[model samples]
Target: MRLIIISGLSGSGKSVALNTLEDTGFDCIDNLPVDLLGAFGRHITELGEDAANQRYAVGIDARNQPEALARFPSILDGLRELGIHCEIVFLDADDQTLLTRFSETRRRHPLSDRDTSLSEAIQRERLLLEPLHERADLTVDTTRTTVHQLRDLVRERMVRAPFELSLSFESFGYKHGLPPDADFVFDARCLPNPHWEPELRQLTGRDEPVQAYLDQQPAIAEYFEQVRTFLANWIPSFQRENRSYLTVAIGCTGGQHRSVYLAERLGEHFRAERGPISIRHRELV
Candidate 1:
């Protein structure tokens, strides 16, 4: 059976992910008690091939007992031993984002009470969910994402074929901080800066003029070739190890220039050889 365990902070779009999976025909159950996960899998296992072929998505949150949440890793191991294909997708957002979301929605956090403030509840939830977060096959940061965008991301990244490795190339500005989910981070600030030109400053790496300017730089060419070569050599090793998702983050002084150019180029280069590839610019959108 293919089982996807969705878990994250209370306001981090976990429900959006589960709803998207359900729309894609997954048999989804939300807020399932952690202790019943093993029994549920065994019950489905005895249901035979038809049941096994049906995709399953379950939502797990910090509402469960602390002891049960702590045993998540072992429970996953047990599921794998039972011949089930299980994967975890952990959704997260920055503390400010979570706080804003809760304030806007006026929804009490699952772990929040009269004694606990929303900020404290958010921090405590993160600590409780650390085990699952560490073992996640994919971690999505929705700090700046809209609900519609989150739904599309879940559909593109999770609802596709099983066992196929999905690769994402993200571009970000050093000013905005690194993407917390990136597996490999490459620095492109050493390359020529397109932001210096007044005309190109208003444009992005996706613009033809900006692309042409970056392409003309000898240093840019060398940097792109080296980064591409390194990833080309190492990506397959990760695939061979059964890694289902990989995020390669490229950063520059500002995400609009060199980093975006390199991420676009790399995504194009690998999309031909790799089956599923996605590109995102953190500062632009």
Candidate 2:
């Protein structure tokens, strides 16, 4: 059984993250009293090691009283002896993000009910878990992530080791903004503004009329041809380095027109040649 121990500070998104792991196929047990970890592993194996995909996620954190910290290492050791591949994932956030989230939601900090301020409690908690945080296989900072972005970051890790990295494409508007999680960003606004053409106003880059119109413009065609070449050249370097995921963003005046088309074309290029990719029109959606 591959046992994944999900532990971190009080408000680091562990509960939601564990839920994501469960959604992706892990047998997740939240706040499993930390003490029962050893027995659970042994029982799973005895019932036929291969019988039930022996994968589990356990959430234990600062919300528990202090003594639980002392018991953590020993429990992990017990799991190791049983031939279980145990790994810990630690989630964290900046003090500011934590404070903002709690304040916005009208929820008091878990350790703040003792008359201690949230900021003070956060500082104390960070210092206490310094050791465990160092040992974590993965550490995620949720200071500026949306729910979907956070889920993607966590979901990519949930795939088994040696998993194929996937490419993602998104389209954005210069006004509404670029995608924050993009690894590669392109300002397609420089190429052409399809919003100006009366006939092309309702069509996007994905539509034949818009694409044909853009194709007639030497600069637009030239730009995309170059971008395609660039991606083809660099993608395999990423593959050779074993990067798990890559995101490319295309932006125009409005996400509805040119950027949307280019993102679709880019997705087509990735599917045609690269191993795998997930494409999205961020603003269009």
Candidate 3:
């Protein structure tokens, strides 16, 4: 069986690296324990000589400061004894990049908790996993790479993977503010408010009737045209940039009227001119 092991220092791109294998139809096992590694291979090996078709991708990280998990080399040797083949894909960025990620998200490092400072824990964990990194079959540097870029790298390596690119377009009410992880954000509230009309109060933008009503507003139509042009320019650019997904959020008051209509239109336009598009109305439904 084709066994892919995604490993790296804590805060490296291990989670993202598995995307390629997952896309390629490998049965992915994330954050598997070190001791269970051999059993996994034994289970897969039982499938017989044709076991080559049955593949696995496992993710291992430094959770719980897994000092004991560093036995990966010995595990690899064990798997070697079993007549199994494996690839160790390691991901790493610089310490500074990881530190910035921690700062930007305001998230505690996995190696450390409230009990310890981030820098110390990161150092401690780095010292632990340094050896396995030296044996990596593939190493990716994610310091300058965006998430989409990282995802694209995985796709490029996984030749037999399926087409798993799912596009999600969302419409949200901006009054509450933008979604934290928006790939592309646009302000549709600048367009005319369809909420002023009592006739359109309950209808959502996904409905043809609501789209028809919003289209009657001349300014909204103009705004849609300009935004459509921008989207057309950006969608290809995003794909060329190797993004796995893009989220475009359109917003207006109540999210039931203008935002909804605009999001629906964007989804349609994107699907027609670009790749497959998945849409979500965050607030307007």
Candidate 4:
């Protein structure tokens, strides 16, 4: 049986991840206590080749008792010894983003009360979930991701063939913040600035004018080739290490032109060479 544990901070889209997994045919349980992990694994093992119950996903979080959460590693060891395939997918977002999400939704923090502020609750939750975070096989940072984007990402990753290293090329702006999930980040600000051109100012890298402008720049070409070469040389190493996901982020001043163009270019270049590729332009989305 295959088991995926979904654990993360509140407001970081754990629910969305779990739902996406369910939509993709995983039998999902939410807010499962950490202490029950072993029992759950054993129970699934006892199910014995029930095709409908072969894949399982459970959501675990800070709501569990601290002592129980601390026993996760040992429980996971026992589960693996039972020949169950286990993977942990941890989701996180920045403190400011979490605060904004809570404010926008008018929802109280899970760990907050009259004595604790929301920020404090977030910090406390972070500390409580550090062990799970440390053991995560995949970590997704959703500070700039919309609900739909998060859903799509979770769905795509969950449905990949076994042992495939899925690749994501994301574009962002330095003005916003770095994508916390990126394994590699490249800066495109030094390239030609299309935001300066009056006609091109309103257009994005996906637009022909912007693409043409960036295409003519010698520096951009060199940068793309070098980055591509670097990835080509190193990606095999990650695949050999059995990595399941890899994210490459490119950032410019505003995530409008250069970064988007480069990310798209990289995605197109790698699509033929790689198994599954996802290209996201953060500001555009």
- Ordered by TM-score, highest first, the candidates read 1, 4, 2, 3
Model 3: runs farther than 4 Å from truth?
64-67, 160-285
In model 1, state the lDDT of residue 52: 64
| lDDT by residue for model 3 (72-118), tens | 77888889688776766677777888888889888778768778888
- TM-score, per-candidate, Cα-based: 0.97, 0.58, 0.53, 0.91
TM-score of 2: 0.58
Ranking by lDDT: 1, 4, 2, 3
The local distance difference test score of model 3 is 0.70
Using lDDT as the measure, name the better of candidate 2 and candidate 3. 2
lDDT of 4 by residue, 1-285 (tens): 678899999999999999998988889999999888899888878777783237789999999998988888998899889878788899999999999999999999999999999999999999999999988888888887899999998876766756678889999999988887789999999998999999999999999999999889999999999999999999999989878778899999999999999999999999988756889888995
lDDT of each: 0.90, 0.74, 0.70, 0.90
Residue range with the least summed lDDT across 10 consecutive positions in model 1: 155-164
In the range 131-166, model 1's lDDT, one tens digit per residue, is 899899999999978998899788767876667778
Clashing residue pairs in candidate 1, if any?
none
Which is the winner by TM-score between candidate 3 and candidate 4?
Answer: 4
**Model 3 worst lDDT run, 10 consecutive residues:** 157-166
Error of 3 at 117 (Å): 1.5
Among these predictions, the greatest TM-score belongs to: 1
Among these predictions, the greatest lDDT belongs to: 1
Better candidate number, 1 or 3, judged by TM-score? 1
Better-scoring candidate (lDDT), 3 or 4: 4
